[model samples]
Target: MDEALWAVGRGTGVAALVLFTASVVLGIITRSGRPLPGLPRFSVTLVHRNVSLAASLFLVVHVVTLMFDPYALLNLLDVFVPFFGSYRPVWQGLGTVAFDLLIVIVVTSLLRNRLGPRVFKAIHWLTYAMWPIALAHAIGNGTNGVEGWFLVLSGVCVLAVLASFGWRLSSRFVEFRSVRLGEIS
Candidate 1:
């Protein structure tokens, strides 16, 4: 039963990471200058928003389950206070830091209109930082990290994020090339 609960927590963490990566990919693909393949621009935006919300929900589950896990020995303070855990304090603190970043990302996104575009965009940039921190937490603290299935899942999530970032970079390059050509022509 303990193992099962741990698996659930691990699975939820992985799922949330994947969803967050997907949201980032979709947002990159649907940028004003980029060409979104089949889906309408508005639809892509909507999907991105929904996926981000799902990721946040999964993160909540992950945190709650960790608190319950006997092995983690986490209290509410461990969730909010960085490095309070007696075991693996530094790595544990990384998870707490990631959680704080996630909260900022979600809150700013939810209140995007009220915050205004500049503020929202600044807050949203923290998502990039959150991803690496979360990834580090999983690798450092996850019990399932050594298992085959978990490894594959983590690889997939990482690859998806990398591919998305690559695509965005390529798109920017293309845009720049086109602009240069136009100027030359």
Candidate 2:
């Protein structure tokens, strides 16, 4: 049972990583105001949201499974308080930090309408910090982080993010302002 829980935790962690990577790439695409092949421009944002939700689900499962797995030795406090775990405290703490930041991002996004665009956008920028922290957690804490297969997976994810980020910086990216001050009347 412990092994099963550990497997689920590890598997979900990997899944969350991949989904988060996709979310980041799609987010870059959405910001560029360009439609994916056969996708309307607006649909890109929908896809990004769905991917992020999926990643969140997987992350939740990963954390929950770890909490239940005796091998992991994680308690509720460890889940919330960064570096509070006895098992590889620093590495586990990174995951906790990433998870907490994600929770903030999700909550702010949900209250975007009530919070106003300025506040929402400022909090959304935390995604930039969240991704790298999550990646570091995976590399430093994952049991298979140093394995060949996991390294390859991480490499691909990194390359995809870098390419997307480069495109985001490039002038070739078309900017489409979803909101216009003049139109606000």
Per-model TM against the reference: 0.84, 0.94
- Candidate 2 lDDT, 65-86, residue by residue in tens: 9989999988999989999899
Ten-residue stretch with the least lDDT total in model 2: 176-185
lDDT of each: 0.80, 0.92
Clashing pairs in 2: none
Query: For candidate 2, what is the TM-score?
Result: 0.94
lDDT of 1 by residue, 1-185 (tens): 77777878888988887888788777665453344677765687788889988988998998898788898778989999898887788888898999999888888888999999889988888877888888888877877766798778778888987887787677343433354357433
Whole-model lDDT for model 1 versus the true structure? 0.80
Error of 2 at 47 (Å): 0.6
lDDT of 2 at 66: 92
Query: Which segments of candidate 2 are over 4 A away from where they belong?
Result: 178-185
Candidate number of the best TM-score: 2
